[model samples]
Each structure stands twice: as structure tokens, then as C-alpha cells.
Target chain A: MHRIRCPFCGARDETEFAYRGDATKRRPPDDADEDAFFDYVYRRANPKDWHVEWWHHTGGCRRLVKVVRHTVTHEVHWTGWPDQPPSLPDGAP
Target chain B: MAITVRNGVACCLVLARRGFAEVTAERLELSLEPGRATIGAERCCLPIAPGEWLVLEQWRADGGLRMQLEGDAAGLAYVSDQSHGRQVIRVAGPAARDLLGRGCRLDLHPRKCRPGFCAATSIAEYACALVQVDAVPSFDLVVAAGYAESFWLWLTDHAAMFGYRAAIETVDRP
Candidate 1:
């Protein structure tokens, strides 16, 4: 079973969290072109290695956290506040 | 060992304004640490989140802690009186940990979760805020009012194996 280390509630089972979509998706400016907005909302990269995603600690702190994980192995490398970027370690893939 | 469940206690959900958690904590003179509670003679302040605390106290005709919080820190926080919206149950016994472990995932080991520790999680499919009140291996579970009946039934049913007794008490004033 996968466990997530919640900054506020310590490590807990992943079942308590809700997997939000990709955290790497950035929203386009309101004045941006239609295509840009479309891609921002609908397009997402499904990477096999390190990928940033969002997870909501619904059952615990009720906060959104950004997590870097490997898609194939489901290994979570790190988790932090949604507004902050995950700091990758040296020589990390 | 005997397990006892006490139902109905006054509670309030206090949400601090952004960047004002410390201000609110100062006003209440309570610690705002996650997974812990600061107990006073008449009240218990539990920090359920970074900016949220669950204040539990016995009901009083003068409004008790809710009155004091509003009178002092209304500008820095939003206090929602949950006295009627939630039901508080205290479970204590030698088998308390075993019974709670059936639904709770938190490690209830005395060394890991000592007295005054609190957690917001699930129990018997219902959301609950749990607090370890003392070293007697006692715990207080706060569940939504709507689920009170079912949660109570679930608790009593499970507690039967360990031999349990329940008491419904009117709120006490200090």
C-alpha cells in the first residue's frame, strides 16, 4: 500500500488522499489565444519518469499537495505545498 | 476491562483568517500544533489543521468557550459553534486501542500517540476527529451530528466484545 507523508498529519495511507490531475499544467493568461487556453485545459503529459502531480489530503489536513512521482513505479519522490515546486535531489532522474 | 462512551459535549470549529493563525492562537492562549491538543481546566483546544482548531468544552448557559472566543478573537478568526452539529464520545478502557484500531489507521500505541495527540481521520466510514485525553488509554471521537446514531450503534456493537457501558450526560459547567 502506498503511504503519503503529509506535512501536517505525518505519513498516512494514500487511500486518504484524492489524486488531482497533473500539477505541471499551467493555466494560460485570460488574453491568450484560444489554442493556448485549450491546450492548457485539456492537454497533459503522461511521463514515465519524474512527473509533478496534485493530491488532496481530503481525509487529513484537507490541503492540496504537489507530489513528484514515477508513473511506472508509482514511487513518490517528494511532496510539498501545491504552490511550491518540488525540489529534486542531485542526480535524480 | 470496561469501555465507556460518553456522548454530547460542546464543540466549536475555529478557522483562522489567512496569516492570522498566530494571532488567533495568542488570543486563545492555546497551542496550534497539528495532531495535538492543549487542555485547560475547562476546555480542550485541538489544532486539526494549520489554521483550524477544534475547541471542545462543556456546555454552559453563558455560551462557555464560544462566547469567550467571539468576545476576544472574532476579528482574527471565524468560530462556528458545532455544539449541535456534532456528537462527542469518549472511549476509555484497556481494550480501547484494539476497538479503535478496527476502523482507525493511526498507530494508537502509547509511545507513538501519547496523551493530548489529536487526528482528523475516518472511523467506521465516518469522518472523525480523535483526541487522546489521558494515559488511561482514553480517547474522544468527534463525529458529525447526522452520523451520531449510526456511529453510536457501531461503537456500541464493536465495544460489546470488550464489555461496554454508555452514559449520556448533560453538559457540566466549571
Candidate 2:
């Protein structure tokens, strides 16, 4: 099982966490067109390489954490608070 | 090992507001740092999260766990009595760590989780706040009241392999 290092609770089994989907989505402007809104709401990228995502430490601290992970290897590159910018790996896309 | 179901444990959930960590800690006389617990003669404080703690006290005729907490908080934090909403279980004796490690993910090695160290984690799929109370390696698991029976069943069932006896201890009010 993958171990996620929660910023507040340290490393714990992945069973203690709940995956919260992609963290790279950006909201369209308030007055943006319909297509922009549709893309923002429905479109998602399934990258095979490094990706930014959100995870909730539900069983531990119950905090939201932003994670940089390699989808192919299931390697967690880094984990930080939701308010902080993700520090991507050296060769991360 | 011996599994004791501790009843009547006076508990309180204290949540320090942002910027009130120091005041709360000072008033309660217990450090609220994560992974740490302050155990006194009759009182113990286990860290639950950043600025959050689960305070426990041995039940007494004049025990005012909530009153004492509310008084200490003195408008600096939020305090809620959990005496009736949670149950405390004590697992003591040799082989305690080995039995617990069967389901707990955190390394329960002596060097890693020494006495006074506590964690908010899960055991046997049930969320619990665990604290190592002494050098004997006795551990106190505070779990939701609703899950106490089921958790007890699981604990007793698994504890059979290591040879365990059931016991009860009292400490409670509302």
C-alpha cells in the first residue's frame, strides 16, 4: 500500500487517506463564455507522468493536502498544505 | 497481554482557536504539540490535531472535567465534554506493542512511540486516539462510544492468539 506523508500527521498508510482528484484545475473567469465554463467543469487530464492532485487525510488530521505524484509509479513526489504551491520534482513535467 | 475496558473516563474535546495555542496550553498546563501527551497524576492530554486535544481525567465524585476545562479555556478555546461519547480501552503487559502493530500502521517500536507519545490514528479500521501511558508500554485507546463494543469484540478476538484476559476499570460521569 502507498504511504502518504500528511503534513500534519506524518507518514501513514494510504488507507487513512481519501483521493480528492486533480488539483490542477482552474476556474474560468466570472464572465467567461459557456465553452470555457464547460471545459473547466467537465474536462480532466489523465496524464501518465507527474501530476498534481488533492488528497484528504480523513483518518488522521482531516486536512486537505496538495500532492505531486507520479501516476505511473505511484510515487508521491511531495505533499504540502492546500494553501501552499506544490514544489514539483526536478524532472517533473 | 491483558485488555481492560476502562469505563467512566472523563473526557473533553478542546479545540484552541487560531493564535490561542499558547494560551490554551498554558491554561491547561499541557502541551498541545502533535504526537505528544502530557500525563499528570489524574489527568492526561492527548493531541488530536493542530491546536486540538482530547483531555482525559480519572473519574472522581467531585470530578469537573468539563468545568475545569471550561474554566481553564476562559474564552480562549472551545471545550466540549466527551465523557459519554467515547470509551477508553487499556492494553497492557508484555507483547502489547506486537498485538497492536498487527493492525496499526504507525511504527510502534519503543524508540518511535515512547511513553508520552500519542497519535490520532486508526486501529482495526476504527478511528482512535492512542497514547502510551507508561514505560510498561501500556496503551490507552480512546474510541467513539458507538464503536466500543465492536472494537472490544475485535480486540478480544485477536488478543486470543497472545493470551489475554478481560477486565474493567471505572472513571465517568456525563
Candidate 3:
């Protein structure tokens, strides 16, 4: 069983949570073009190395949390709030 | 920081009931009961489909039993411990419907989320559980426990705005 650490509830089994997509998303500027807005809302780059993931703490806390996990190893790099940036690997591609 | 029991109304329940259990293709079976999950024969009888069973431990994935669970489990996919990390808020009374209107997006109708059904969704900007506790319009909100205090405040604050009054009530697993 995969045990995930909920930023609010400590380490818990994966079931008590919901897996949202990547946590890292660009915030379109107020005066950005339609294309930029569409990209921010739709397009995404699924990188392999240290990746940012969005998670919903469905078990207890309702706040959206961001976790940095390795896509391959599934090892958590770090977990933080949505505004926080995910930690990157050395010379990440 | 003070972990205030904000309202002296929360109740701890003796939730000793069988939730859900499953057996995987690996021939691994799992069960989520009240206290904890264990492989094979345990003292308490489970009125469930015959298979492997494990009680849902409302604690962290650590220590002896956890290790047993790790080894015995086909995977942690079957048993879930959604109780610990999240706050469970219960909002009852006639105005319960009105109170939930502000944040909940799912259909709050009784038939939609009837008894014995669980909805895993969000309310406003928070993760929440909407259960119809009473036949006569009472409902419960099982949310991330960490945000319990805030949601409680929000519920009451908006409840007042919605002409509804609420108090903390204890929630136990049965």
C-alpha cells in the first residue's frame, strides 16, 4: 500500500486522498492573450523527472496541496501549498 | 499553538462497523472494519462476503500492525484510512440544507446521496463529506480534520447568515 503524507494530516494511506493532475500550472496574466489563457488552462507538459503533482486531501483537510514526486520512483520530493514551487532535481531537464 | 476543541460539541463514536473489503487478482483480500484490519480469523465476526479482511486503522501507517498490514495486504488499495487526516464536521437541523448550499456543489437532494452512499467531493475551497445523517434533513460533513476549525467557523458564520443555528456534535464510527 502506498502511504502518502498529507501536509495537514501527516502520513496516511493513499486511499484517504484524491490524485489531482500536475500541481504546477502557469497563472495567466490579467492582460494575457487568448492563446496564453488556453495554454494555462489546457496545455500541460508531462515531465518525467521531479514532477509537481496536485492532490486533494479528501480524507480530512479540504485544502489543495502540491506534492513533488518522482514519476519513476514515486518517491516524494516535497509537499507544499499550491503557491509553493516544487523542488527540482539537479540540472533537471 | 492551541488546538482548541472550538466548540465543546464534538462526540467520539464507537464506530465498530464493517465498511468495505475486496480481494484482488493476486489472491490478496482486504477488509475495512471499525477498529483495525487483520488477516484471517479475528475475534469480532464480520458479516461480509467471505474473503480476506483487515480493519481500517484510523492511525498512521507505522508500527507492528502496520507492518503486518503491509505484508498481508495485496496492496493498500483495498483498505483506506480516510478518517484520521480529515476533519469530520456534522451540520444538522432543519436548516442543514441551507447551510450546505453556500459551498457544496453536488446535488444535496436526499435521493441523490441517499443513505449508505458516500460522496468524495469538495465544498467551496475545502474537501468535504456530505452524509445524510438523519432521515429528517440532518447531514454531516466529513472534511479534512486539519481544517475542521475553519469549516466549523464558516458553517456557523454562514449558518447564522442563512438563519440556521448549529452546535458541535460528536461523530463516532459504527
Candidate 4:
């Protein structure tokens, strides 16, 4: 089981958190075209290496946190608040 | 272990003003930090999340605590009475920590879970708030009313293994 470190609450079991989707997605502008909105909603990248995503500390602090995780290894490299960017180590996937 | 199911306690949910600290210090005289509770004689302030707290008190016939908090939180916070919506369970004994560690993922070792340590996490898959009460190694588990019965059943069933005695009392009794 993966242990996620919450920004407010300390590290807790993965069962306490809910996987929010990819954090890289940005919503299209309000006046953007319909195709742009459709693409923004439907399309997503399923990366294999290091990926940036959002995980909600549902059972703990109940806050949205950004996490950098490896898809294949299931290793969480970094975790922080949603406002902060993921800072990965050198040579990290 | 000894377990007491506290009944008729006054519970309040406090959401502090964003970007500033208020209500807790001015009204309750408790300073809140992340994952720590400030305990007073009759009151305990537990941090539920960022800028939020669950204030529990020993209820009296006059219902003064919630009323006073509502009045004091006019523009500072949003206070909701959770007296009937949540249940407080106190577990104490020499083996209290061991009993709780069964389902609690957070480290319950005395070295890490000293008095005033508090966290909002799940125990046995039920979301609840846990706070260390005193050196007796007592812990107060605040759970929602909806999950109280199931949580109690789970607690009692597991507690039986350690030979626990159950009682009913006020929040301050422990």
C-alpha cells in the first residue's frame, strides 16, 4: 500500500486518500470553442514514467494535494499542496 | 482496556476565516496548530482540517457552550452544532494504544502520540477524528452519528480481545 504524505496531516495509509485525476489539465477559456472544451474534458495522457497528479486526503485532512508518482513502480516521489509545483530529483522519470 | 461511550456531549464544528486565525483563540482561548489540539479543563479543540476545528465540551443543562460560541463567532467563523450528529468515545487503559493500533494506520506509539496529538483519519475504514486526552494513554474518538453504531460495534468487538470494560459517562469523566 502506498503511504501519502498530506500537507497538513502527516503520512497516512493510501486507503485514506482518493485519487484525483491528472493535475496537468487546465480548463479551456469560458469563450473557447466547443471542440476545445470537448478535447479538454475527454483527452488525457496516461504516462508510464514519473507523472504529476492530484490526490485528495479524504480520510485525513481532506485537502487536495499534488503528488509526483511513478506509474510502474508505484513510488511516490513528492507530495505537496496544490499550489506548489512538483520538484523531482535529478534523473527521475 | 476501559472504554466509555460519552453521551450528551456538546460538539461544534468551527470553520475559521480563510487566510486568518480567529474564533478559537478569542473565544475558546485555544490556539490551534496543524495536527495538535489545545485542551482546556472543560473543552478540547481538535483540528479537523485546515482552518477547521471540532470543539467538544462537557454539556450542561443550560446549553451555554454552543450558544456562547455562536454569539462569539458572529463575523469570525461559521459554527455548526454537531452535538446530536456526532458521538464521542473514550478508550483508556494500560493497553489503550495497542487496542487502537489495530485499525489505526497512524503511529500510536507513546513516543509519537503524546498528549495533545490529534489527527483526522480512518479507523477500521470509518472516517473519524482521534485525540490523545492525557497521560493515562486515553484517546477520544469522535465519529459521525451515522457511523457511530457500526464503529462502536467494531470497537467493542475488537476491544473484547483485550478484555475491555464499557461504561457511559460525560466527556470530562475520562
Model 3: CA > 4 A from native: A1-93, B1-21, B24-84, B162-165, B169-174
lDDT string for model 1 (B1-174, tens) is 343344336788888999999999998876777787898877888888888999988676545667778888878998888887888888887889999998888898888889898999888668899988888888988888899888989988888888887877654545
TM-score of each: 0.92, 0.92, 0.40, 0.92
Root-mean-square deviation of every model? 2.3, 2.1, 15.5, 2.8
Backbone-clash count (model 1): 0
The numbered model that scores best in lDDT is 2
In model 3, what is the error at residue A38, expressed in angstroms?
21
> What TM-score does candidate 3 get on C-alpha atoms?
0.40
- Minimal lDDT window, size 10, model 2 chain B: B58-67
- lDDT by residue (tens digit), candidate 3, B44-157: 111121232223223322343334444555343334433345455556566666667677654566665443333444566676544454455655455566888787777777
lDDT of 4 by residue, B1-174 (tens): 888889957888888777645544567565567778989888899987887889998886434666878687767777888888999999998888888888899898888899999999999998999999999989999999999989989999988888999888844433
Model 4 regions more than 4 Å off? A91-93, B22-27, B61-63, B170-174
Worst 10 residues of 3 chain B by lDDT: B1-10
Cα TM-score of candidate 1: 0.92
Better of 2 and 3 by TM-score: 2
Q: What would you estimate as the lDDT of candidate 3? A: 0.51
Report the lDDT of model 2 for residue A73.
95
Name the docking class for model 3: incorrect
Could you give candidate 2's fraction of true interface contacts? 0.60
Whichever of 3 and 4 has more TM-score, that candidate is 4
